[model samples]
Each structure stands twice: as structure tokens, then as C-alpha cells.
Target: MRVLVVDDERGLTGALRRGLTAEGFAVDVAHDGDTGLDLATDRDYDAIVLDVMLPRRNGYDVVTALRAAGVTTPVLMLSAKDGEHDVADGLDVGADDYLTKPFSFVVLVARIRALLRRPPQVRPAVLAAGDLVLDPAARTVTRAGVPVDLTTRELALLEYLMRHADRVVGKVELRDHVWDGPGEDGNVVEVYVGYLRRKLGRDAVVTVRGAGYRVAG
Candidate 1:
């Protein structure tokens, strides 16, 4: 899963990025509300950690803008204020969840997991192609009811392919989604595809002549 942490506090955001990555989640950090809002609006993140106080744009404004733009990606609002009005306002402005400052990382992760439990309106929980099954919650892949252990990058690549099953996913698409934010080696996609084909088997995923890859459904 991918998460965006939007906070001006470099220390807090950095800690979140490290901690969430360690927990098997791809993370992106935004130091300000504008950058954060842009990422949240443009990308398909599993969840967002947005601080209520921000420069140029507050959390409420950011959430309102996202909702107005029809970005229903779940958001967890963070604030130092525990006042009843603040909490209510955050919820009223479209935050899916709220966390007061001095919060425990454990609790924050728990809230994120809970929000993720609710099905995404755009992305489904389980993605499958032919006999292959991927459970996002379990982070497990199975073929013909047999388990397949995948490396972190492999799992991420497979998940991306599954999401666009049967479509010709170009190298650019793969790079943007599977790898971080592009600008890496173009051959990285091909290399990772080769790795996935070796482990998941060639028949499980196919390559087009000029296009990129597809998982035959």
C-alpha cells in the first residue's frame, strides 16, 4: 500500500516515512499543504496523514478541495488541538479520521489500518487474474491455491499489474507506479518484469510486442 504523509514538521514526517516504509508501505512525503494536496489529488494513495495546521493551506481547506475534486482517498487529520470544535470541524470538513498530537505511532498505524479496512470506492481489496489471487490485506499472493512468497518490490509490481490486468501497461506506467516517482532507469521495469516472470511464471503475465505487460485474465 502507498501512503502520503503531509506535514511541515520535518522530524515528524521523516519519522512517519521511515516507520511506514518499515511496515511494508510505500511512502511519499510533502512538506507543505500545496505539495501534499497536489500529490493526494494526482496519485492513488491508500491513505493520507494530513496535519491540520499548514502554510498556504490548512488541513480543512486541503480536505475540502480534495472532496470537491472528487478525490475520495481516505484522509487522517492530525492536530495539536483536542478541542471539541476542532475535532468536529475536522470531521465536518471531510476527514475520515482524526488524531491528536503527541499520538503514538502504534495508534496512528492502527487508525490507518482501520481506515484501510473500509473498501476504497475506486480500488478493490482483492485483485485476481486467471488462477492468481492477490489479497491486499494479507499482502499475500497465491496461484492455484498454492502460496507464493514475493519480495517487496515484486509484490508491488504484481499489485500494479493486477490493477490493470489484461491492459497493455507501458514501461512508463509501471515505472511511475511500481518504482517511486520515475526518473529511474527505464530498463528497471523490464528487469523487474523479468524477475516477476521468473518467479510467477511466464504464462501468469504476458508481454505485448510494442506495448509493455499484461496479466492475462
Candidate 2:
């Protein structure tokens, strides 16, 4: 999972970066709302952690702009204002979920997991392909009921491929979405696919001859 945290509080953002990273999420931090809005607008993120009180643009305006621009990624707005209307204002502007100041990290993670599973009728929280299972919330992967430990990058790559299971995902697509962009190395995707294959099994991810890669649904 990828999360963008927009907050002016340096200490809080620092702690969030470390904690969320430990949970198998690729996290980016922006100290102010303008930067946050830019990152959210430009990148494809699984979720966003936005702060209401900000330096340039407040969280409300940022979310409003994002919705107007048609970026429908889930947002969990953070605020020190715990009043009834304050919470309403955050949701009213288009935030998927809201969290007040001094909130528990566990609850925040749970709320994010819940948000990811939105609409309930579609998009299962836990992803599976045959006997391979990936629990995004727990950041764990298992094959045939046996546990597997994957590096953060490997997990992200596997999740993206599995999310679009059975479809050919091009190298450029994986580079943009998984690596965030092109890197100096041209074969990064191939290298990581090799990493996943060693752990998951040789047949887990299939390569399309003229296209890219696919994970069986």
C-alpha cells in the first residue's frame, strides 16, 4: 500500500513514516497541504492521510480540489478539532474517513483497512490467487497455508500484479505504479519479478510473450 501523509507537524509525520513503513506500506510525507495536494494529484496512491490544519491550503480545500479533479483515491482526514461539525466538514468536503488529533495508530490502521474495503459489495480486503493469499492489512503473504516474508518492494509489486490478476501489466506500467517512476536501471521490473518468483514459486507470475506480466486470478 502507498500512503501520502500531509501534516505540518514534523514529529508526527516522522513517526507516521516509520510506523507505516514498518507495516509494509510505501509512504511519502509532505509537511504542508500544498505539497500534499501536489503529490496526491500527481501520483497513484492507495490512500492518503491528510491534515486539516496546514500551511498554505487547508485539508478541506485540498480534498475539494482533488474531488473536482476526479482523483477518487480514499482519504483519511486528520484534525485536532474533535467537534461534531468539524468532523462533518471533513467528510462533507470528500474525505472517505476522519480521525481526530491524538488518535491511536492501531485504530488509524484499522480505519484505513476499512476504507480500502469500501462499498463492501466489491473489492475484498484480503487478496487471493489460488492457494496464494495476501493480507494487505497484516502485510503478510502465504502460500498453501505456509508463511512467506517479502521485502516491502516485493510485496508492493505482488499486490499490484494480483490486484490486476490475469491481466498483462506492462513493464512501464509497473515502473510507474510500483517504482513510482523510471530508475537508472532498465531491468528493475524483471529483477523484482525474479525475486517474487523465487519466493512464491516459478509459476506464480506468468510473462506474456509480447506484453508484460500477469498473475493468475
Candidate 3:
């Protein structure tokens, strides 16, 4: 899964990025709300860990703008204010979830898992093709009862293809969904597809030559 961490504290932001990355998530960081808003506006992310007290623009304004612009990716608002009204304000501004500072990483991970389970109104969780199965919530994949291991990026790409199984998923779309940023400038999609093919089997994912790729039964 990919996540954007928006916090003004450089130390905290770096810590969150490293910690989350270690926990099997592709993470991008933005130190201030302006940069955060820009990245959030420009990219496609599974979720956003937003801090309410921010420079340039506050978390409330940033999230409110996102909702206004119809960016429905889930946002988990982080704030030092643990007051009832503060929580209410965060929700009122359209944060999908909220966590206070001095919080446990375990709780944060749990909240992120919960958000991934119910990904806004966009991508759904479970996807399947024939006997092939992927459970996004569990981060698990199986083919005909045989479990398989996939790297974070591999799993993300495979999930994308599986969600659109039998249909062509172009390189740009794959990059947008899986990489969550611009200009990958490498054969990452192809390489990860190769990895998936190796783990899932040679006949699993099919490249559409001059088009894109597809996952088929």
C-alpha cells in the first residue's frame, strides 16, 4: 500500500516515513501543509496521514480543499489537540480518520489498516480471477490454494491488474496507481510484473504487446 505523510515536524515526518515504510508501505512525505496539499492534489494515494497544525495551510483547509476538489482518498488527521471539539473539527473537515500525537505506532498501523480495508468510494478490497485470489485487507495472495509472497510494489501492481482482470492496464495507469508519483523512468512495472509472473507462474499475467498488461484466468 502507498501512503502520504503530511506533517510539519521534520523529525516526526521522517520517523513516520521510515516506520511506515518498514511496515510494508510505500511512503512519501511533505513537511508543510502547502507541499502536502500539492502532493495530495497531484498524486493518487491509498491514504493520507495529515497533521492539523501545519504551516502555509492548516490540515483542515487542506483536507477541505481536497474534498471540495472531489479527491476522495482517505485522510487520517493527526493533531496534538486531543480535545473532543478538536476531533469533531477534524471530522467536520472531512478526515476519514483521526489520531493524536504521542500516539502508539500500533494504533496508527491499525487505523491505516482500517482505512485500507474501506478505501474511500474508489477501489474495493477483494478481487479474483478464476482460482486466483487477492485479499487487500489481509495483504494476502493465493493461486489455487497455494499461497505466494510478493514485494510491496509487486502486490500493489498485481492488485491493480487483478482488480481489472481480463482488461488492459496500461503502463501509465499502473504507475499512477502503484508508484503514486511521476516519472518512474525505469522498467519497474515490467520488472515487478516479471516478479509476479515468477511467483504466480508463467501463465498468470499476460502482457498485451504495444498496449499494456492483463491478468487472466
Among these predictions, the greatest lDDT belongs to 2
lDDT (Cα, tens digit) per residue for candidate 1, span 28-102: 889889999999998888789999999889999999999999999899999999999999999999999999999
Task: Please give, for residues 22-85, the per-residue lDDT of candidate 3 as tens digits.
Answer: 6666689998889999998998787899999999999999999999999998999999999999
Ranking by TM-score: 3, 2, 1
Candidate RMSDs in order: 2.7, 2.7, 2.3
User: Could you tell me every candidate's TM-score relative to the true structure?
Assistant: 0.83, 0.84, 0.87
Stretches of candidate 2 off by over 4 Å are 119-122, 145-152, 175-188, 209-211
Pairwise lDDT winner, candidates 1 and 2: 2
Q: For candidate 3, report its TM-score.
A: 0.87
Put down candidate 2 lDDT per residue, 181-207, tens digits, no spaces.
664266998999999999989899999
TM-score preference between candidates 1 and 2, better one: 2
Distance from true location, Cα of 48 in model 3, Å: 1.2
Angstrom error at residue 79, model 1 = 2.7
Q: Which segments of candidate 3 are over 4 A away from where they belong? A: 180-185
For residue 207, give model 1's deviation from the true position in Å: 1.2
